[model samples]
Target: MLSGFSSHWHYLWLVAASLIAGVMNAMAGGGSFLSFPAMLSMGILPVQANATNTVALWPGQLTSLAALKSDLRKDLLPVAALASILGGLTGAEVLLRTRQVTFLHLIPWLLLMGAVIFGISGPVSRWLRARSAEPHAKRTPRYFPLFCALFPVCFYIGYFGAGGGFLIMTVLALFGVDEMHALNAMKIVTACLSNLVAIITFIVRGAVLWHYCLISMVFAALGGYIGARYARRMNPDVLRRIVVLTGCVISAYFFWRQY
Candidate 1:
């Protein structure tokens, strides 16, 4: 649908980008930072870029779901999906009602903070893991705070998802969900819900680039499938480092350019 690139060349890039995006999304959460920028650089405008990126990411979620259907904890999915969907809807309404230029100015700083928080997550998690073996009763108050904590984060994802994966990972960690496969599963489901709402809102506003979305979804799906299949094979810690570094660089680039 996107003219200029030959079918063969475009498909290659599509698969490459989607693969990168799927792996990044599963491992960290900022896959959009990669896919969105790539789209923009290829000539799509901001609004269209956002819409197309949301649609593109759906496939990644689907792929992840298919790959991890067995390992998924069904109990958490309903609540996470509800929270993400409701928050996303609210975010879309707020975005529709407000001016976004102010938020754009704030994105880099927010992403930088997210990156820093994510970077220390490993160490903090290690420390927490050290303080082990508490009674189940004692842990309730310790971990229960995280469900309510997602308010601002999921709302932001619905509004703008740049560093959302980082936020999701952080929230999951807080809630005592530490396994990468489980976390990835949660991310995929929650993201799917969030993006579904955002995509609908964007479509109503006529913001989506259908051609770009169509092409990108195919690649993103494939990438997500591959990542899901091989998720257990890679070192999750290394993947986390790569994602954090990417977020830091992207945040810095935007901060320098805009500020």
Candidate 2:
């Protein structure tokens, strides 16, 4: 009843939607706002959709971490990586154990929360920048305290990552990471590690729907490459606003669909 088989059309839609999501993430953040739902619409169950989405978008985070490697706070990397792995594995396990219907019910709330956090990130960054303007002592990062703070954020990233990167940056700033590059570098590292562990968990548990995940991953990479070229020329603030708005609107739509 269509131009091609239903399966082919669905794959086409997933590819196109993932391309746009990648562009959004490269320009700003919040690609999951599109990619997760695209997986769902393809009839993947909620938990699997989430797992597949996480796996699909993970390489970009790795790419970022690679580029920022020189700025990584070496003093903080061990604890951060440990926390990310522990929390990410726990979150992925919980997601896998969750009943399908319950996860579907929680989707809107998760999306809304991610959007709200993202909306506040810009203001929080400005505050960090202003505070960094002052001369302050180089406080040694409290490893335990920093890990405690980051565990939940990385767990959330593993569960449903949209705005978790910003949360990591904010937490790092709060814990005396004064250099912007260091903060960015650490954020990417933790996020990448979080996803890496989750990806492993998903594969071990057979949660990722690879048929869709593969297409999403390839197209998203292409989109990221293309978007990165134009990102420097665009106003980041404007793009951030657009990403936040898109997340909010999509969350609202999901909420309506649920209730």
Candidate 3:
């Protein structure tokens, strides 16, 4: 255990951080960028930070899932759960096999692309909004196919989770899922799979700091709960814009620094 009152202070900081992470995660997926860095700066070892962050994410996921329990009933829950399990396992396996060095090379390009896509999200949403009065039946075939194609997005979420929310939102929209439900369900399930699988894998590899993970998880859960509660009151369009802008800035930084 951490000595003195510093441990409690750490917990408090983590709680606040988790709250921010939860909000960002519920609204987008790049919340890790914040939480991970915070942990690193707090003197957590690199591997420990990663494992702890993943573990902490669990609370947030559970919170989000609980909030959406009603809508996630019937066939949806089972299928989504199955998908998360399978996809998360695959992603963890891939992460294990791959070297972080490879990602270093790709980060720049990925960020640039993310920025471009974010820049266009507003116009895309506007176009869709204009068509709100039209029968969406005609667009089903084209859109559904595009959405299904994004199943691989889960793999990436499991691997990194940098901007998985943006990808999910974009893909879900293409498939014609309503914005709010998709955001809620996607955040919860994705977090479940990504965090659980990664935590298991990292633990087996001896990559975790159990004390830190426990502390972070506790706070992150609190954050996620508060975030979900807050999201319930916000406008999707407004939240989306904020997420997009933030994503663009992150992507730009990656592009310039890594590329």
Candidate 4:
């Protein structure tokens, strides 16, 4: 148990972390990169921290989704939603079955992969735009193939979810959904669904730290609002770079500690 001062400091730290996470999530897609470490630093166990992080960041995701509701409705695809929900359920089940040691071992690789994906997002986006502009270029393949591709991405989101939004945006872009706002909207919806299933599983299994989750959620939502309001002034490329750097540093630190 924490002493009074320690407890106060922990909460303060969490509030600051969640607020940054919300801004990062709104600007780019790496909120988990902040919130997860914050919890771990507070002596929360890995599994509990993951569960609590999901719950804490969930409300901010919902807020983003609400803001993007119009765009989502305009370009929403049923198959994508179905794939995300199904994959998320499967991934959450897998996470529940995982041992703490195993999850600790996996964290570095997951973070590395998320970082690589985020780092390449800009180039990938540019390439997609170029391809889309070409004459007689194919926009998207068939629904089955797209569904298959999105399933694993959603599964990852359910399991760890650090940079899942970048992956989702890439997939959507490949599917010929080139509008930035639409892509972001779809990313938020898919992420929200993935977290929804995982949070339910965490709740059922008694894994979530509800008090911390509640505190982070409120602050994260506030951050999301602030980020959205100031989005025009923020550079997404800079934010993406920061997220990539943070992911690499965190991954390296965890790797060293665990190994």
Candidate 5:
């Protein structure tokens, strides 16, 4: 009884972290940089923390999708959806089979990579925008190539999830999707689908902490609503910088912990 009580207290911060994660995801795109490390700091095993984080944030991603429904392009939907499902399932299987020590060793590098990706997102977005504006520019790559590219990205989403949206946006931009709203809309759909499969896999494997997942889900959903409503008022560039800094700090700390 006392242990359960203490466990509850230990997870209180997950609620706060998830709320902030939801807001950050809504405003910018790097919530996992916050949520994943927060769980790790609470002494959750790396794989369990990742699974729990995915379950906690899945609802919020769906909420964002609902809010961005009008922005989604039908032409880009079917193939990406298939890739997301297949890749997510494959990635979840891989994660479940991985040893805890292996995941722990890989955490720092993954976090660092995620940080670098977030840091350069703005510049990349601008470049994609310029390229999209050229009169003779190719609007999209052939469908097969785009589908192939999204496979690895969706796999990463199911495997780790941190900064996955940024990766998705980068791929979409390369596919000639330069409109900010449209890119975000596709990101939301793909993330939601990918996370859905991951969540199912984690649940079946008993990797998620149900109590923590439930609490975080509620708070994240609330944060998503508030963040979406106030998105225009927030400076996304500032939020992006903060996320990048936080990712760097978390990565350094995890490196120290692991080594």
Candidate 6:
């Protein structure tokens, strides 16, 4: 049995981290920078921590998908759905098979990659937003090409998603879907669906630590709700910068920890 005060502090730490993660997610879009590390700090194994983090943050995406369901393009759905399912399942299975220490060593590099991707997205997002107002003829994207573009990113999402959502949005924009509504909607659907299968894979493989997962999920949900209320009042650009900075800082910390 653990010492009483120490155990209480551990839970309190998780609660604080999860609340901030939820708020960050609702405000900007980088909660994993907080929640995933919180899982690691709890002494959970690397693979299980990643799986639990994915599971914990998933419910929020469902609400987003529901709210944005109307904006989803029927044409793109087939490609996004197929890619997310196949890639996510494959990624989760691969993660499960990864040796614990190997995953541990990879944490810094993965976090760095996510952070760098997020930093680049700031410009891409603005470009997409500006491009959204212009009218363009509808173009049909080939299923195979679109699937090829999305599959590896979806696999990264299932494996250790931090900033993969923007990558999906970028891919969609490149495929001639510049409208933010559709891009955002499809990103959430792809993420939610992909994460859904990974969640199942982790659960079946017995990789998630349920007690922490449940707590983080509940508190993160609460945080999202609270953050949503104030999201409109806050400046999105500022929030985005903060999130980017947080990801980079966290990535650096992980690098420091490893080396």
Which residues of candidate 4, in runs, are more than 4 Å off? 1-7, 73-76, 129-141
Give one digit per residue, the lDDT tens place, for model 4 in 1-259: 4597897888788899999888887777787877888887778888788889988888777766777788873435686788788888888888878998888789889888888988998888777667556554334447787788899988988888877877888887766776666677788888788889888888998999888888788888888878878877988888879989999999999999988
**Which regions of candidate 3 are displaced past 4 Å?**
1-16, 26-29, 42-48, 73-79, 100-151, 169-187, 225-259
Indicate which candidate wins on lDDT. 6
Question: Please, what is the whole-model Cα lDDT of each candidate in the order they appear?
Answer: 0.67, 0.89, 0.60, 0.81, 0.84, 0.91
What is candidate 2's lDDT per residue for 1-259, written digit by digit as tens? 5745887778778988899988988888888998898899898999999999999999887777788999988889899999999989988988999999999999999999989998999899888887777777767688898989999998988888778999999988888888777788988999999999999999999998888899999999999998888999999889889888988999999999989
lDDT of 3 by residue, 1-259 (tens): 5565776676667666666777776654456655665565467754456556776775666655676766532434444455556666676667666655665555445545544554566676566455544455422324334434444676666665555555655565555654455444654665466557766877787767777677666666666666666777887667666756666666566567655
Q: Superposing all C-alpha atoms, what RMSD in Å does each candidate have to the true structure? A: 4.7, 1.5, 5.3, 2.6, 2.5, 1.4
Evaluate residue 43 in candidate 3 and report its C-alpha lDDT on the 0 to 100 scale: 70
Error of 2 at 201 (Å): 0.4
| Candidate no. 4 TM-score | 0.88
Encode model 5's per-residue lDDT on 145-186: one tens digit a residue: 888999999999999877788788899887778777778889
Clashes of 3: 1
Per-prediction TM-score to the true structure, in the order listed: 0.72, 0.96, 0.65, 0.88, 0.89, 0.97
lDDT tens digits, residue span 61-112, model 6: 8888899999999888888999999999998999999999999999988887
Global lDDT of model 1: 0.67
Winner on lDDT between 3 and 6 is: 6
Worst 10 residues of 6 by lDDT: 1-10
**Which tens-of-lDDT digit does each residue in 1-259 have in candidate 1?**
4564565565566557766887677655567657765665556655456566777786566655677667665667656766787788887667655544665566577668757766776776565454433322222223235546665677777776665655676677567665666666666667667877877888898777777787777767666666767878888788878878987898899789896
What TM-score should be assigned to candidate 6? 0.97
lDDT of 2: 0.89
Query: Order of all candidates by TM-score, from best down to worst?
Result: 6, 2, 5, 4, 1, 3
Least accurate stretch of 10 residues (summed lDDT) in model 4? Answer: 132-141
Instruction: Decide which is better by TM-score, 1 or 5.
Output: 5
Best TM-score among the predictions, by candidate number: 6
